[model samples]
Target chain A: MKFSISRSQFIKTLNDVQRAIASKATIPILTGLKIAVSETGVTLTGSDADISIEATITQSDEKAQLLIEEPGNIVLPARFFGEIVKRLPEDQMTLTVGEGFQTTITSGTSSFNLNGLDANGYPHLPEIDAENKLTLPADILKQIISQTVIAVSNQESRPILTGVHILVKDNQLLAVATDSHRLSQRKLEINNGQGLEYDVIIPGKSLTELSKIITDDLEEVDLRITENQVLFTAGPIKFYSRLLEGNYPDTDRLIPHDATTTIEFNTQKLLASVERASLLSHASQNNVVRLVLDPEAKEGTIYSNSPELGNVQESLAFENLTGEKLDISFNPDYMKDALRSFGPTDIKVAFTSALRPFTLVPSEDEENFIQLITPVRTF
Target chain B: MKFSISRSQFIKTLNDVQRAIASKATIPILTGLKIAVSETGVTLTGSDADISIEATITQSDEKAQLLIEEPGNIVLPARFFGEIVKRLPEDQMTLTVGEGFQTTITSGTSSFNLNGLDANGYPHLPEIDAENKLTLPADILKQIISQTVIAVSNQESRPILTGVHILVKDNQLLAVATDSHRLSQRKLEINNGQGLEYDVIIPGKSLTELSKIITDDLEEVDLRITENQVLFTAGPIKFYSRLLEGNYPDTDRLIPHDATTTIEFNTQKLLASVERASLLSHASQNNVVRLVLDPEAKEGTIYSNSPELGNVQESLAFENLTGEKLDISFNPDYMKDALRSFGPTDIKVAFTSALRPFTLVPSEDEENFIQLITPVRTF
Candidate 1:
């Protein structure tokens, strides 16, 4: 392959694809990024076993400044070549295939001869037809992933919990993720119907990488689901992730249907107060912080106690407090995460009792997102 | 301590002293900060075995808003309390010492009751007289520490090498540090003549902590050297660091006087070129990058080769090239460090040969700083 491209455009494309490059060299060939040069432009592909990313640079875009001379493919070590190109002090870079599967990259006065593997040795990306594609706003997808992905379990004991379960009905799309300790659920309404109802589990790790490349400014992203793989395409980038095959737990039962007391508080104020209380509670065994509600005083108080250190109490003014006055303790970190995910100026927290899980949602009815956290047994 | 002070001021003082708080819990008291409240105001101190810091808040600057209700001293866990006050969403925090050495910290609607240890249980700071003190520009000290501290050995094999040696002559102050493999020496001309000549070795770790609290904006800092500790007092902050008791090696002989060749080039360009070359060289057993210079051409070429990763070559243009043509290889990381420390638009490099050490200094004569790195013997 022989091609000349703008340094900035090449770096930007390489960055998008490099996230999927295998960090571990167990399979040496998998550590390299495959580059293909065509008459139109150039395409770079990087993949581990779990995810694959391909970024295309087109000559049609005047800003890209890409000129293709020969059409071929080569696979070069992703990290080293990426660093070399990034540090090269030049506006344009040239790539050419040399003898013995060697790739020569030149920019300014710097040139690199990289030992490359044959493109044929790299694994091919899964092909998904457009007929199985569904469209959604990129912003909605990013929001769903960010809100729920952090709740996914890092432990592989139950591999399904490591993935975010996505369910698309006739007009609504729902995303849910939980690691048994905490859960996040978000729903969005999509106008276009794909004429199909499907449920798929996409790994949280892959969604995180996909989120990094997707711009919130973009309006739409095409998502295609195959039996074993899921593809998300935006503009000139195609992201493919291996789907987790298993039945996701019934999270519907995990969320509480009724609440004894519900209080609306400022999100920022609550987050800061919880963070301060966590400083003491984090030293304790259960990292628990207690919340006390006073209907007469119309105030909500958060307290944290550590046997060896100290105790902290913070009183927050609430917009409204109803139902029986209650005192409950739960993990401060979970509350912090739940409050952060609310992403609204005001949040309403519904609590049943000390033993039951609580739900946090935006005070405004526009955003349909909920986060639930099970209270810790402080006694 | 029973004092109500500005929250920002208290947080800033806590930040400075907390740097000395021990991360390890080997000595329980070492992990806590001792606060003394008197008619004068409040004094906060934190110490590990190697370093201690003390910051005082005077009653005169309290502006009537800050009140000292009682005089007392107590030690509280540093990490937890520091984090609590920093994250508290209040403008003013009131601290009160109650019965049983219990401390209550209240700010806005938040309050913390911390279990505190009696001041008698905390170790006393070393007493140092300021009469025979020497004052230096804080920026200069920060620069000296940053330039030479990185070369100090982290290994405990050579205890003296883990500290930077400061030698005070009649009219000069010299700082030297080495890790056996490489050495860095810096000298500054001082006008003050105390008619005293002394050599003290300060631990690299202590200097690192000191550097963090010493702002470049501060004009001068008083340095008081006692029998076992050195104290740096800048404004209201007093930093004490235990001296490393050992004889530092004589690093004067390590700097070569004569050079076979010398070249001047853009510092940033050379740094970028070396970084790109390092991408390949770092993959090999010996991370070495070779520089070949032709005096006649006024141009130099750098190359890095890895057995499994091929090679990278970059040519750099020099402003001036003199003396004999040369070829030398050295670890790119050392050169990167030297370049980072020797911050200037242009750098002049003097090389003895392929196997000898070289010196890098700013091309401008105004900035008097030099960094030397030993060449790796790459077979």
Candidate 2:
């Protein structure tokens, strides 16, 4: 294959697909990125067995300035090839595949000859059903992914908890992720559900990568789910992730309905206070911070202590406080993540005794999005 | 000590002193920063036994807004205190030392009570010969530090090679550093010699830290040398470093005066080509790139390859080439560091033979600064 294209435009697509290529894949061929050139366009594919990303550049693309001399395919070492393209001397670069898949990249007076693997040896991508695709605004999908992924379990003990449980029914899309200790749920109203219902557990990591690729330039992202694979398409980029097997835990019953005390605070203010309190708690063994709220006294205080480092106490800033007095101890990192996901909005936090789980929801939209955290039994 | 100061102003000085504070200090007190508050100003000192940095914030400084309520001293954990000050909620923060060395730092409604040590336990800074002082432009000093420190040996096998040999004599200041494989030498002309001569070896790590603190705001830095210490005073910041107690090797004889071949190229262009060749060389075991210069053909080419990956060859751009044909191989990493130290200028490279060391110097002024690298004997 021989093609000359705008280096900057090619680099953009290269970066997008390079995200899926792992540095050390068990299958050595998967470590390389597949490049297929045709009369109409060029397609770049990268895979790590579990996740695969494909980006296409067409001759019709004005910015790409693609000039195809021949049609063929080659798989080059993803990282090294990327580095070479980035450091090319000119605005444009030409890539050609020669005898025995020996590819040469030439830009200005510099040329890089690399041994390429046969693209035919690459594993075939899963065939997604286009008719079952569900489309959503890129912004909303990105927000949902960011909010829920934080609660996904990083541990491999419970494999299902590593994914976000996505459910679509009655024209409402719900996304939930939990690590047993904390849970996050976001609800998005769908206008074009088309009377279709589907339930799937998508790996949180996949959603994170998908959210990143859904840049501001992208208006919408289309999702198609097969039995074991899910595909999300944004513009010319197609992202495919293998669905996690087995049923996700029912987290609907995990959120608390009743609360003994409730306090409203600006997310930014509480985040700062929690971050400060965490300094000492992180230095300590248990990594727990305590929050004391008194209804009659109308006071709130956050405290944390490290045996070797000392202690910290701050008068927590709150907009509103009501109901019974309560004292709770929990992981400050979880609280920081939940507060950050709320952005700069005012959030109301509800507590159900010292050991029970507490929920934090945006004050204006309490029913749509919620973050629940289970308190530590530090008696 | 009790003082209320602008958090930003305090943080600047805190960061400067924190550079001297090591995380795992041999002396426990050296791990902490000593804050000595007087009616006139507040002094923050941090030391790691070998290097000690002290920054003074005066009450007259408007930006500091330092309000000295009392005169006393206390030592606080350098890193922890810096982190606390950075995350404080208000522009102004008050730090007060109470009974039993307990320190309370309050800003807005957030308060951090930290365990403080007795300031008297902190190690005393080295006393230098203030009368015999040499002042130089901060920019020039920073440049000299940056140029030579790159060649300093990181391995502690020969501890003296880890420092830059500095000699001041005959109205000229010369600095040189080498790891045996590559050497960098820089010389600065001094206007006032004062008929005094001195030679010292300052640790590269100390100079690196000192260079960072010499920001653009500072005009000049005063150097005071003692029996075994070198102190650099930049405005209110005093950086004290213990001198290496050994004689430096004579590097003047190591430079070759004659050359069989020579080539000149823009520093930036040559650096780019070297960087590209390094990509493939880095993947290989020996990590070497080859340079072929043929005077008859007026051609210069750079090549590097990996047994497992492949190879890269580039037609080198040069302004002039003369004398004899040569083929040399050397570690690209050493060449990269030498080229970067030259900044952006046309450089003349002189080679004696394929196995001999080559010298690179600025084309405009060849006498003041020179970088030499020993070529690898590739069979």
Candidate 3:
């Protein structure tokens, strides 16, 4: 493969593809990135079995500054190639692959010859049906991923729980993630026909990588879901990820129906108070922080005590504190995460009792997002 | 200790002392900071086995914003105290100690109650005689430490080599460090009389911490060297570090007397080329890069080849290449370090032969600094 490309353009594409290159892959060749140059353009691919990323630059893309002299293919070690390209002395770099897959990269007075593996050895990307396809704005998709991805189960014992369950009906798209301790769910409006519905469980790890590729500025991404695989196309980049096989658990019933106690406060103020209280609770084994509300006094306090370290208490005034005097304890980290996922505004926190789960929702009705956390039994 | 100190001032003092607090110390009290409150001001002390730092804030100083309610002393856990002071909700924080050393820190609506150890249990700072004293600018001392400290031996086999050997003669202060593979020596002129000389070896780890405390704005630090310890007093902060006991190695003999080949080049240009070559060499086990100079062509080339990764070659036009043609191999990391130690200007890279060690010196005559790296034998 012989091609001369602009350094800046090549760098952007290389970074997107390198994200899928596993640090340690079961198959050694999977650790490399495949580079194929044709008379028309160039293509780069990286895969780690579960997710694959392919970026393409065509000769028609004058901004990419690509000119293909020969048509060939080779796979180079992803990390070494990336590092070398980043340090090239000039703005333009020319790549040439010789016999036996010896690739040479030249720019200015510097030239790097990297050993390349046979591209034929790399596994081909699986084909997915495009019958069920939907186009959504990249910004909304990124928001959905960030809001729910953090709540996915980190343990491997329950494989299905490690993915975010995404559902697309008539004109609505919903994403939900729960690790048994906490749950995050978000819904958005989609422009899709009523004749089709899509349900897929995408691994949280894959969504994180996808979010990085789908930057906020990008306008839209075309998504296609098949039986066992899903393909996402953002501009000239194609991202493919494997779908989880098992059925996702029904989490609708897990969310509490009615609230016994409700309190409204500034999101940032409550977050800061809980963070200070967590200073001591984090040192404790249970990582629990108690929330005490006084109806008559019209005040609320966050308290945490560690036998060996000490104790911390913070009082935050709430707009509306009503219901029977309530005291509850839960993992402070979960609450911090839930607060961070919302915009800086007032949030309504509802609790059923001290031992049951609690839910937090933004006060504004425009954003359909909810976070639930199961309280810890402190007494 | 009881004081309503400025949150910002308290944070700065706490950070300086916390550097000396060991994460896990042999003596439990060493993990806490000794805070003494007086009618005039407050003093905070933190110490590990090797080093101790004391920062004092007096009421007379307008910048500290300190108010002493009572006079007392108590030791609080360094890490916890530092965190609380940093996150106080208000500009002013009031710390009050009650019976049994129960300390309460209150600010705005936030309160933290920490268990404090008795001040009597904390170890005392060793007494050091001030018979030999010299005052030097903090900027120069920080420079001397940065230039030589990187070469200090990290291995414990030679305990003395782990510290930088400092020799203060009639009017010059010399600092040197080496780990057998490379040596760095730097000297600065001090305004000392021809009466007495000072010699001591301070641990590299301690110097690293001291560098953080010596900000650029500070003017001078009083240096006092005793038999077993050295004390540095910068403004209201006093830093004491234990000196290493064993005799330093005779590194004077390691520097080459004459150079057979002397090549001068721009420091930044050469550094950039070698950094690229290190991309592949660093991936290899030995991290070796070859330097080939051609006197006839008045140019130099850096080359590195890995059997599995391929090769990299970079050529640069030298300012002046004289003497016989030469080629040598050495660890690129050591060369990078030696080059970085020099000021950004033309540096003279001198070599005797392929087997002998080489030296790097500044092309200018103002600063007296030399770095030597033993070349690796590739044959």
C-alpha lDDT values of all predictions: 0.86, 0.94, 0.90
True contacts kept of 2: 0.77
DockQ of all predictions against the true structure, Cα-based: 0.81, 0.80, 0.84
Q: Pick the candidate with the highest TM-score.
A: 2
Q: Judge candidate 1 at residue B266 and give its lDDT.
A: 82
So what's the TM-score on candidate 2? 0.99
Model 2 agreement with the true structure over B1-379: per-residue lDDT tens digits: 7999999999989999999999888888888999999989999999988899999999999999999999999999888888899999999999999999999999999989999999888888887756878889999999999999999999999999999999999989999999999999999899876965889999999999999999999999999888799999999999999999999999999999999999999989999999999999999999999999999999999999988888999999997799999999999999999999999999999999999999999999999999999999889
How far is A72's C-alpha from truth in model 3 (Å)? 1.1
As a whole number from 0 to 100, the lDDT of residue A254 in candidate 3 is 85
Q: Measured by C-alpha RMSD in angstroms, how accurate is candidate 3?
A: 1.5
Residue B26: error of model 2 in Å?
1.2
Cα DockQ of the candidate 2 complex:
0.80
Model 1 ranges off by over 4 Å: B62-65, B366-368
Model 2 regions lying over 4 Å from their true place: none
lDDT by residue for model 1 (A1-379), tens: 7888888988888999999997676778888999988888788999987999998898997777898889999998888888887887788888899788888989889989988889998888888875867888888888888999978889999999999999989888889999898999999887886576779999999999999998856788998888889999987899999999989999998988788998888888888888888888888876888899988878789888889888988888678889879889888888887788776588888899988888888888635888888887767
Q: Candidate 3 at residue B254, lDDT?
A: 95
Docking class of 1: high
